[model samples]
Target: MASNQASNNTQQESKFTLSMNHDMEQQQICLDHQQVEEKEFDYSKRSQWLRAAVLGANDGLVSTASLMMGIGAVKKDIKVMILTGFAGLVAGACSMAIGEFVSVYSQLDIEVAQMKRDNKRSNKIKGNNEDEKNVLPNPAQAAAASALAFSVGAIVPLLAASFIRDYKVRIGAVVAAVTIALMVFGWLGAVLGKAPAIKSSARVLFGGWLAMAITYGLTKLIGSSGL
Candidate 1:
């Protein structure tokens, strides 16, 4: 009876050990699944759009504002400033759109060509199994984003100038408006890209100020020279 009891205990321990191991494996699998799901959830993936949009907007704000301010220094006429600003807005937007489209399309073409070469090389070898590589870049979408962003940035300074009468006041308003818009844009870009907002905002603001100041100074020098 004692020997039978010992055998029964041994069987029970074996069964318990197997059951515990099975439970542990199930728990491990569950944990792995959860980890994979969590990894797939990412908020920073929107940087692709933010990258192009922010750059376009920054260029629009700085370039259009600088142009108008340069002309404003020499000519205080509101119509001239408005006309110059409007022309810059249109030209800059078009340029940005075309440039972005071409650049993105060129990159896409190169990638496609490389992918084809890789596919050919892979097929020449025996018993090689590689995942198919496909890449598509939307040039139209990028162009549209750039154009729209440029218009948005350019309109702010123009609107500010339109409301003011004095050249000095207009210049001040344009500078202030561009600076604030740039700061906001930089902050928004930083937030979207998961970067430091303060640093980004400060850098963009300074760059914009320097651009407008330099342009205004040059125009003043030229004006004084009667050129």
Candidate 2:
């Protein structure tokens, strides 16, 4: 009977050890699964339009606001301010679209030309297939993106200062609206582009404020000079 009890104890201990090993394996598998689920972020995909989008919006906000502030400072007429703002918005949007299209198309053309040259040389040697399959930028897509972003951003100040009748109030409204919108744009750009948020926001905000101030100051000076 004593020997039988000892044998039973040995079997129980063996069973416990096996169970513990099984549980440990399961825990390790769970950890591996969790690690697989957490993936590193890839920024290459976002980089394509991230730059154009940020630039488009920044240009729209700054250009439109500066134009409005410059004109509004010298002349208090709402019509003049609105008309100038509208003109800037339209012209700026078109310019951005055209600029993006031309710029991207030119770059793509150059790259294609270079690739063709490379392919010719490569074919003369042993031939390379990698360059042929390289992805190039789409000019239409870039133009559309820039135009849309610029238009959206440009409208903020126009809409903000449109209703105000007071000259000073309208200018203030434009400045306030532009500064706030620029900060938001910067933050959005940073978040989407995976950059530092505060730095981006502050940089955009400062640029916009400086633009308005300079525009206002220059226009005021010119107005004071009576020419």
Candidate 3:
């Protein structure tokens, strides 16, 4: 009778040990899943900033380069080209900054209003107001980021054309520089956004080329017509 009792106790202890192990394993799995979900959410949140920055840079590069090319079409002076590019860089940066600020401020206002309405609907539904507020966009930060990105991109063409004194060589240098920058920007945006690299690069390159061509052609036509 004592032997049987001892065996029964052993069996129960073994079962209890196995149960504890299973619970631990299940908890580990749950933790891993939660971590993965959080990582994905963080990545999605960061994508918005990446998209805005890439857009700002591309706009700055294309618009500034086009302006320089247009001016180069009319005037062969390197000084003139450089000056036009500098002016474009400053103006474009300011424009991008202001536009981003206004847009983001509007979005912030809307989000704040929505949050207020949601809070009024159900106190229990408000899980964490601090977390929600932390995720909200800052207009000033957006504006600064846009302005800095635009300035960085606009500098590319200015540096490329600065040293080349010959009109033809300067034009070629500007084109080459702009092409490379466009490809880099597109590839970067694609990689970050998980889009097709080839399509993104091709689209950006083609758009840049089109803008420069149109600007150059129009300016040349106008100058030639003495208008």
Candidate 4:
């Protein structure tokens, strides 16, 4: 009888241990799922800053180079060319900053307005609304993006002027730099904007080239007129 009682006690202990082990396994699975969800939601602000910095440096190099080239093409004096380059760098950086800020702010405003509209629509159609919250760009993200864009746009030209020597080479370098930067920016915009990469890249490139061309033509005409 004692042996039988001992066997029954052993069976109960085994069942209890098995149940505890199962619970532990279930808990571990839950923890893993939670970790994965957190990982999936992660976004890095530093990465955006790094991208902007690279873009800014590139912009600085290109714009300064282009201005120097255009001026050098007209004016043979090294002093005049350098001075013009310096001026262009400062002006370009400021222009880039302001332009970026304004453009980003405008977009941000539009997005906010859009989100508000969406919310109202969602409320009106409660049953039909299928988690539209995931579709909108976070406000924080837009702000970060804007800040990065402006910062990069402003800093590059200024730094480029400091490094480059030959006015014409600087100009060529600037053109190359700007072209590359535009391409990169386009890609970035497309990724962030969640749009077609090729289309976005083309748009950015076109705008950049148009600005450069206008500047080049105007400067040339003015230089030729002896003005």
What's every prediction's RMSD, in angstroms?
4.6, 5.7, 2.9, 8.4
Please say which candidate is ahead in lDDT: 2 or 4: 2
lDDT for each residue of candidate 4 in 55-105, tens digit (9 for 90 to 100): 554465456655665676677566776677667656766665666566666
Predicted model with the maximum lDDT: 3
Report the Cα lDDT for candidate 4: 0.65
Clashes of each: 0, 0, 0, 6
Best by TM-score: 3
TM-score of each: 0.79, 0.76, 0.85, 0.47
lDDT of 1 by residue, 1-227 (tens): 99999999999999999999999999999999998776545544566777888998999999999999999989999999999999999999999999989998997789778867876877644333233332367788888999999999999889999978887889889988998999999999998777899999999999999999999999999999986
Computed on alpha carbons, the lDDT of every model, listed in order, comes to: 0.88, 0.87, 0.95, 0.65
- Model 1: ten consecutive residues of lowest lDDT: 126-135
Where model 3 places Cα greater than 4 Å from the true spot, the runs are 1-10, 123-135
Candidate 4 lDDT for residue 185: 74
| Model 1 misplaced regions, further than 4 Å | 1-45, 123-135
Model 4 scores worst on lDDT over the 10 consecutive residues at 128-137
Evaluated at residue 11, the lDDT of candidate 1 is: 100
Q: Model 4, stretches more than 4 Å misplaced?
A: 44-53, 69-78, 118-227
